[model samples]
Target: MALPTGPATSWLQRTGFPSQLFETGDNDYELYEAEDEFVLSVEMPGFEPDEMNVSWSDGVLNIVAEHEDEQRDRRETYHRRFRFPKDVAEDEITAKYTNGILEVRLPVMRGATVSGTEIEIQG
Candidate 1:
C-alpha cells in the first residue's frame, strides 16, 4: 500500500507555522539574527504574559506557556527549548508579548571576543 503524500504535506504546510519550528511539536516560533542581536518570535494564541515563562539556564533557552478556559473547559499549553549560541549574552535577554506573539531579543556582548587575534612575528 502507498502512503499519502501531497495532500498531507499541504495540510501541514498551511498551518502558518513559524520558521524553524516544524522540527518541534505543538508550538511554532521564528528566529532572526541581526548585527547586534538575535530576535525570536513565537506564536501564542489565547495566552497572556502572566501565563508564559521564559528563562535561560545552562546554555539552554526555554519557553513555556499554559492556560485554561474555565467557561469552555479547555486547556492549552506550549513548550519549546533552544540551545544558546556561543556568543549569546544570557544576562541581556529581554522579552515582550503583544497581539498573541512573543518576541525575545538577545543582545550580543559589547566587549566579548568573537574570534582569536593574530600576533606579528618579531623580525
Candidate 2:
C-alpha cells in the first residue's frame, strides 16, 4: 500500500504501524533552558520505565510508550517527537523516569547559542 504524502507523514511512516492503532495520549511536555543545558519534562502516567522508549536521531527526539492494564482492559500508546535545538549535544542526552514523569536533559555545547544575533546589513 502507498503511504500518504505531506507533513508528519515521515514520522508516521517511521512507526510502520497502522494509523488506527495509533492513539494520542495525554503526554504534556515542559522545556526549560539553563546556562548549561536544556531540560525537558514529559508527563506520562501509568507507565513503567521498561515500557517506554526514547531516542534521538537526525535532530529529532522521539518518545514512544506502550502499556496495558489487564485489570481494566485498557491499552495506551504514546508517540511524541520534538525537533532538538541545534546547540544541544545529542550524545549527552540523559533521561530518567520517576513518579510517572519522564525527565530528559540535553546538555548545551560550550559555545551554544542561547539567542539570535543581529547582523548589520551593509549597503
Candidate 3:
C-alpha cells in the first residue's frame, strides 16, 4: 500500500512554527463531522464572548482575545500561547462565550469538498 500525499501535510512541514504551541495546554478542541454540518468545540476560559474575536479567511480560522486585569491593585501578563488550524473559513465561523468557556460553532458548506487530488488507477 502506498502512502497518501497531500498539501495539508506539506503545509505543516513548510510552516516550521513549533507545533507544540498548537497542542499544548489543557485547552482542547473537538471536531464533529456529520452529513449536514461540521461542529468545532473549543475550550476557552477566562474570556467573555464579547472580548473574543473570531474570523475565517482563505480556509483558515483565526481567533484573538485579550484578557484584562480586573484588579487595579495588581498587574498581570498573559504568558500562554496557542496555535490555530490553518484551513478554517474565518468569515463563516461563529463564537459564543458562556460560563468561563468560549464555544465556537462553524457550519461546513453542504457541497464543500476537502482540498486535495484524487488518484486514478490504470489497469
Candidate 4:
C-alpha cells in the first residue's frame, strides 16, 4: 500500500496501528504488570467491536483489527502480538474495547514465576 500523505490524511493514516504510533511520541499501547495480572491497553479507533479480534494461544496475545471503506475501495488492517514473561491463567484472560482503546487483562497463575537469567555487562 502507498504511504500516507501529508495533507488530507485520515485517522487511518495517523494512529491506525503500531506503525504510526512512534511518530507521535506517545504511548499508544501501554503494558504493565500488576500484582496479579498483566494489563495492556492499545489505541485503536474507527473500528467497530465486530471488526476486531482478540485471542490468546501459547502464552501470546494477538490483536487484529480491520476497517474497510468500500466506497473508497480502501482497507486498513492492524495486527500485534504480545508474549508474557510469566505463566498466565489462559482460561481467565479477558479483554474489552471501549472508546477506541482495547484493554486486555491476563491473570498470572498462582506460584507462577518468570524464568530468566539476568546478564551482566562485560568490560
Candidate 5:
C-alpha cells in the first residue's frame, strides 16, 4: 500500500470530520500580506456558512465551526487560532466563505508596531 503525495486530507468532511484530520494538524491555510492587510485562506468543505464562526481578540484570530446531524447523531468540529505580528484593526476585520474556502482579511492599523525586544546572535 502507498499513500498519496502532498498533504493528506480527510474524506469524512461531511459527517462531522474536518478535512485533513490526520495530517497538517488541521491548520492548513495560506497567509500573506496584501497592502495594509493580512489575507488568509483556508479550505473547509461540507459545512454550511451558518456553521462557521470567526472572531478576534487581543492579538489572536479564532475560527470555529461545527455541524450536527441530529438524525445520524454525528457532529463535525473545526477550530484554529492565529496570532498577528503587528497590531490589527479589530473592527475592520472581515471574513467570507465561498466555494469551500474561508477567506479572512485583517486590516493593519496605521503605523502599528510590535512591542518586543531585539534578540542578539551568539558568536
Candidate 6:
C-alpha cells in the first residue's frame, strides 16, 4: 500500500528524537481549541484514575502517574521518558478520567480582545 504525501511524507522522512520515541510508547495526547476553552486529551492505558495525578502550576500542566510495583523482590527496568508541553495555565486546568482516557478542560482567561463599538455623542 502507498501513503499520503505532504505532511505525512515529511513526518515519515524525519528521524525521531529520544523524546519522540518515548512519547509514542505510552504518552499519546491531543489538544483542541474552542471559542471559550482549550481541551487536552491524554491516553493512559492500564492505569486507574486514582493512580494518576494532574496539576497545573506556573503556567505548566503536569501529569504524573506511579504504577504499583508488581514484584516487590526484584528491581524493575525503565524504558522510556515522555516530555509534556509547558505552555498551558496550571491554575485553570481540570481533568476527568473515564474509559482509560484522561480529558482535561482549561478555561481561557480574561483579557482577550473582542469586537465592540463606541457610541458617538451628539452636541
Best-performing candidate as measured by TM-score: 5
lDDT of each: 0.73, 0.77, 0.53, 0.80, 0.80, 0.57
**How well is each residue in 7-112 modelled by candidate 2, as lDDT tens digits?**
3454664554344454444448888886798888999889999999999887678999988766754566788888865577888999999998999998888886
Better candidate by TM-score, 3 or 4: 4
Local accuracy of candidate 4 as per-residue lDDT tens digits, 3-99:
5434335564454332332233256699999999999999988778899999999888988888887675566667788899899999999988999
Clash pairs of candidate 6?
Answer: 56-90
How many backbone clashes are present in model 2? 0
RMSD of each: 8.8, 7.4, 12.1, 5.7, 6.2, 11.8
* Residue pairs in clash, model 5: 10-20, 16-75, 16-76
| Shift of residue 16 alpha carbon in model 5, Å | 9.4
Q: Model 6, poorest ten-residue lDDT window?
A: 73-82
lDDT against true structure, model 5: 0.80
Q: Model 3 off-target regions past 4 Å?
A: 1-23, 70-92, 119-123
Residue-level lDDT for 28 in candidate 2: 82
**Distance from true position, residue 94, model 1, in Å?**
0.6
Q: For each candidate, give its TM-score against the true structure.
A: 0.66, 0.69, 0.55, 0.74, 0.74, 0.54
Predictions ranked by TM-score, top down?
5, 4, 2, 1, 3, 6
lDDT per residue for candidate 1 within 1-123, as digits (tens), equals 643323334445455332232234444788877888888898887999999999988667899887767775445567788775546788789999999999999886776444546789999
lDDT of 6 by residue, 3-24 (tens): 3322323444343212122223
Give lDDT: candidate 2, residue 10.
46
Q: Cα deviation of 10 in candidate 3 (Å)?
A: 40
lDDT of 3 at 11: 59
Q: What is the lDDT of residue 82 in candidate 6?
A: 23
